[model samples]
Target chain A: MNPIRKVLRAGFELIERPFDRLFGPALNPVAQLGALGFFFFWIVAVSGIYLFIFFDTGIERAYQSVEYISRDQWFHAGVMRSFHRYASDLMVVMVLVHLLREFAYDHYRGVRWFSWFTGLPIIWLLYVSGITGYWLVWDKLAQFVALVSSELLDWLPIFGEPIARNFIATGTLTSRFFSLMVFMHVAVPLFLLFIMWVHILRISRPKVNPPRMLALMSLAALLAVSIWKPALSQGPADLARVPNGIGLDWFYLPLYPLTELWGNGSVWAFLTAFSLMIALMPWLPPLRRARAAEVDLEHCNGCARCAEDCPYEAIKMVRRTDDLPFPTEAEVNPSLCVSCGICVGSCPSSTPFRRTEELKTGIDLPEYSLRQLRERVMDVASGLSGPGRVLVLACEHGGAAGRIGDTVVMPCVAMAPPSLIDFILSRDLADGVVVAGCAESACYNRLGVQWTEQRFAAERDPYLRARVPRERIATVWASALAASKAEAEIVEFAARVAAMPPKRLRSPLPVSSTVPTPKALQTERGTT
Target chain B: MKALRWIGQFVVIAALFAGVAALSDWPRYSQIPKDAGVVMLSFVHGADRKGECRRLTPEEIAKLPPNMRRVQDCPRGRRAVYVELDVDGRSAYRADLPPTGIAGDGPSRVYQRFVLPAGRHDVAVRMRDSARADGFDHESRKSVELMPDQMLVIDYRPENGSFIFR
Candidate 1:
């Protein structure tokens, strides 16, 4: 990592650590910032639908109807109005935080760039939709927004004459105008939803919504806010006179003041430039793509385990073309692959019992295969001389600085199959094994830390056998910048292992007993 | 214990929301002010005189595609109207009202407001509808008494060929 990025990451962690400490890991706001944005959107959508029921989209009646909802129905409809406004504002705040978090964590480059690039337009679309929603009230703020927006639009030479004339005075605006504004307020959100969906398309098993308890709490909070301070409109729009000043929603309408300070053209120029820079940020410091995974049809059983475990959805199960004696085979799509190699861990053919010339798995990363990974694990475990001899299977992205001896780095800790851990401890290659990777929620590969945890807990496939003592292994999640924490965890784990008695290993099975016969392997693979 | 902690977090979030809502002190529905006076200036400017195209001949129409042909080759563009207002011998407002709505060419309408003290004052308004640089196509000047919180309206009627005040 470059010095600039390292400093930035350090700064971000410094700011974030306090919140993690205060809120505890599970309730950490920073960890769940992305999902919070989605939760806020739901609140906005629900409240907006409620507001739409009482809304009157006519130039003359728009303000009056909104006033009626605000005053006459203050308890229900009025609160809903406030909820809609505040939730929309909160959504923008959360989206910005989420963006900053992704950048701070350096998750916006290489394969993750798609999510970042798709997110840029969402901010603008959200602003447009939110501004249109305010316009529906036809209040003083709406008048100011419409005027400034029209002035901005007029900056473009596409129109023959200035569009600002529409809001020049009373009676100039018609119901058709209000109708179009309402249409945009409705339609733009649906378009934004499509964009958000596309933003997560590259990710497998995307968590679009936050946890259930968090969602409920968020909704309750929004409701409480709405009831306490109902959303109210400013005085009705009068285009005949210039407004002195209107209360501004800095979240969505930050650019309105800029229009006043600098002319419309300069504001447009600044916004265009800023957006362009953000869109091109992924390439500012170009990152080399990780090696793509490769599949050997000879070993693949068409079980689709790798496809299911892939965090990037890079692997697909296709019909076997050759006479490989398999009905289907997993194929890795190079363009989508991040090469975290979690799929290699998911492959049952990745067992250490293989005595072939090369320790080939059904699917493997070009740079690091399961065979090479096993050899590294063995080398690290055997090399340890002291009594507290510990083998730490660490993620390359995880903040393992090689401070603790006997460390073997995998692309992700999930790339280390449970069998590998079993092989190390059962064979007495190491007194203890410690698995460490990126923070569970903040995993660079999304599901790497999560799947690793599940695998270690014996809750998922390729589970650590019941015979393997749970106390012999430990899983620690830390970011690449948090190497100190990972080192401390390894030291603590080594101490705990040292306190326990020596491992009682079962007699080793013969190669034939553990490894599947060639004919049986092909037949068993066919059923999967 | 875990469930209790989860519930406690939920309570804290709810309390935070209530606290923020109270602290914000947002305007209530019943608090809308009613004493402010509104001055309405509404008018659709007369059609542009410059760049007005003549009607196409029957032979010319026959030569064009069905979608392209129009019975009359009317002017596609309308000239903007210049409007100026003065109060108490001082220029108060000025704007060039464009022809039509945002999407296409249509009658150019303008609405504006000016809040003044409740008293009698001399008001003057002028508009140039066409491309002529000579003078205003229509003009109005008057001393009008305005009551406190009164709604004053200024309108133009092409049929009457004059500005109307109320």
Candidate 2:
């Protein structure tokens, strides 16, 4: 091989032998989140279908159907309603977490700009989906959703059509609006998934699955939730009355707090500006510079691995006409590079390809796994039986799990779907589910904590208009370097959940509603 | 004036009769209820060659060369799947699942249920494939609102070789 070819070949070889040491990379945090998110979606989809079977789309019947499903079919229909609502909340969270992890890790700045740009719209899409669900319930919250949505649209000047008054109109029940929401709920995601394939195509080694335990746990939890809580709605959408403290889904409704702080228009301005800035984020200075990639011609191979491996598409293949002997080679687009080392990690070909300086470059080892490792710690604390198992789910940073006060640890918290969280809580399966993760940026696989907390938050989604306050899900974060902090956080969360009154082990409702145990309902389920 | 009114209605009635004869065997004499509820369904599984559902458009049919109104599902003599409406909810609408279940049972054969209050109703049906969609049969089924607890069905059984509504 020529000198330049030899050099390029060597650069590629360093990636092939990534450090395999540690408790074995059972899961990559990013992959774990994706796997968990997929299961969460199915949870939503299945429960949504169940709710659909009984959903009445009219003024009088819509609320009645929801009531029948929640109050009568509490085990099946009720659980599905809650699961669907909760799972949706979780899915949005996972997506956001994935975005944040990628962003903090500098994965959003480089050639992957296209992927980032395309994905930004998905945030809006998720919001629309959640709002649509609210409307589908046709409850007080839904009425608020419907009114706000229409008021927003009414500001637009597109009503000049001569025959736009057959059914759905601004002042009345519009078949048009319902049709639009239905179309958006399903279609937007389909479009997003299509774009996602394109985004991943630019990168090699895209993970589409989570760990086995994570996947199963998510599915089990979703099923358990759908069965236990079964999502239902509140009363019919009473547009005339605004219910105080109508339970709100805080994940997507984080914007609600903003709305509360700054009334509508200013918030809209904030959002518009924020969105536009994000869409144009790659243009931000200094962020437009390389975070950690440099092309060494001596170590580089012309395989275009960097180009293919970059999640953000930061590298491009260019001709090696200047100084270099090879006719073709690849160059890093410094401005767009996320320096994720995926390209560096995926490379390994024969020397006949060429040679380059082999930096003893090692893959930051993968420590992601999802065993109830925390359960073992719980046993040590004697917390499992004494108070009931406080399930502290901590992230597997590089290889080992972290324990706080002798409790749980795992990979990304997203891996545990709310169903699992609820299952452990409702069945008294575990005393609590304490999720410890790396700070969003430090997560090696990206999006570990985001998913974990999101799924935890999903438990509280008020789909049936029943606000199930999130059960025993908490987050504590630190860098992989700080194992002690990781331990401290998990223990604190478990202690908190375990200390609560045993009667508070009530199935996922807020600590307030003074209604006696739906003993008849609970008995029916136990019998089943 | 009386004679003129009589002549005008007679002419109008004659025109309607001629137009009805020219198009469909059954002509709608009255408009169905405006509030009639229905579920829009793609009952035929993989009915669209793409295995995706599509809304029909007018230009789609305009491209057809008149001779091909009905397209065959396969070259073999197997009876091709065709859309059949189930007016009764699932209890009255029986779809043969066989060993393969809902997936093997095409969407055209599977009947979904739709319930509406007592009033007039106008339902539509159409066929779609990967590349194009067949012209829709708009206002194809019209029914007077059934009294409470009443039932109705629009059957298209090729084996029986006829379309019937009750």
List ranges where model 2 is wrong by over 4 Å.
Answer: A1-31, A155-171, A174-180, A198-201, A226-228, A256-261, A286-528, B1-166
Clashing pairs in 1: A168-B111, A169-B111, A169-B112, A240-B112, A240-B113, A241-B113, A399-A480, B100-B106
Docking class of 1: incorrect
What's candidate 1's DockQ score?
0.15
Q: What is the C-alpha lDDT of each candidate?
A: 0.77, 0.48
TM-score of chain B of 1: 0.69
Candidate 2 residue A460 Cα shift, in angstroms, is: 44
Q: For every candidate, what is the interface RMSD in angstroms? A: 7.1, 32.5
lDDT of 2 by residue, A205-253 (tens): 5555665644554555555544543455545654323322355555655
Indicate the residue-level lDDT of B61 in model 2: 52
Among the candidates, what TM-score does chain A have in each?
0.92, 0.53
